[model samples]
Target: MSEKPEPVDYTYTPIGTIHSPFKDIVGMPIQPTGARGIRGTIEIRSDLKGGLADLERFSRIILLYSLHRCTGYSLKVSPFLDPTPHGIFATRSPKRPNAIGFSIVRLVGIDDCTLTIEDVDILDGTPLLDIKPYVPAFDSYPDERSGWLGAVAHNAQHAKSDDRFQ
Candidate 1:
């Protein structure tokens, strides 16, 4: 028999929660492109209010969240954008050990501790971990390597997430 790895513990509390129209997993967009113009709001914790100051300076922000609904881990997965299985690191499959999610969304408005955003692909009530301004100059690229995703990025809008992680 193979030896088992030891476990380590760490703790994190959600700074906020995302509220979106997507209640069910079926038929929901697997990524932001498919969820074009879909609206959502992030309700940030009052204690973290100070951190959000000046966030309105940018029209877009990157949301880092937790896929609380997903559990477990897999080193290989058939991602929504492809048929053949690939390493988990090659795709944003939520069945990661950390269950983290990321999205670059258009900022609509900010009201107190809540932020209205668009192009949402995450599920409702997802835990918000952090947010950062999206600067195209730093985040955009003219040409870059996509590896396996290069072939399917064009069809990603039509891709729907299935239970490959579960």
Candidate 2:
């Protein structure tokens, strides 16, 4: 008989919580692109101040966080922009086993331990995991295949949040 693999558990305490104008789940922007110009603040705990050293040098940063507002998961889901179903990993749709979200937001400023950001699509109070500078020289690609997303290029700028992930 084959033995089942043991479950590995890892824990992370949030360094801070996000504060955004979007309180309700409905009618919010589904992606950062759709949420352009929106603003939010990341309230980092004072103890984490040392970790943020030199963060202000970057113009934009990537935010890895938890989608705490989403309650369930599906192996497959229809994204806000498409009618066809897609594999969970292939789409940026928020429904997942871990409910983790990733976004690249403009760093307007950093005061003390708080970071004021723009292009905020994340929910208020979302648990922030990590932050990294968005370096276009290393991160941007002028030509790349978008897979299923290529079928609906127009939706990227227009899709708004829906309750499908709830």
Candidate 3:
């Protein structure tokens, strides 16, 4: 038998910070759809402001951020929309091996290094790892199966996060 591969450690620096209305996770919307019209701002580091060029052209952008508030992880979790515990990979639970979270939000406007965004569900002061233009052609799959989520996906629009993960 071949030897097992060793686990590797990775490091990433925050490129910016996400500012949202949510100061705690107790009553915040669980996803973008639930936070519809909610506005937020992304303050990019001054040195990285140059990267914002041409990014404003996209109507929506995907934000990859650190779930700084999550201290640990569980392989199976009870997501906001569903009470049934599911594998971490099958659900968008903040409790993960890597505390990373992402959201696709409407890009309202860009000013200097700050980006005005809407439909935000992330926590305030979350560390932004990166941003990418959201292209529906590359991201959407209308006919694909969402497995267990399909049954309760509609509930997301009305779901609010509780302190279960905390």
Best by lDDT: 3
Q: TM-score of each candidate?
A: 0.91, 0.93, 0.98
lDDT of model 1 at position 92: 82
Report the number of backbone clashes for model 2: 0
Global Cα lDDT for candidate 1? 0.87
Residue 66 miss distance in model 1 (angstroms):
0.8
Superior candidate under lDDT, 1 versus 2: 2
Give the per-residue lDDT of model 2 (tens digit) for 46-163. 9989999999999999999988888788888998888889899888888898888999999999999999999999888899988889999998986999897887866867877877
lDDT by residue (tens digit), candidate 1, 62-119: 9998888887888898788777988889888888878888999999999999999999
* Top TM-score prediction, candidate number: 3
RMSD of each: 3.2, 1.7, 0.7
In every candidate, how many clashes are there? 0, 0, 0
Compared with the true structure, the alpha-carbon lDDT of candidate 3 equals 0.95
lDDT tens digits, residues 30-108, model 3? 8899999999999999999999999989999999999999989999998888778899999999999999999999999
Clashing pairs in 1: none
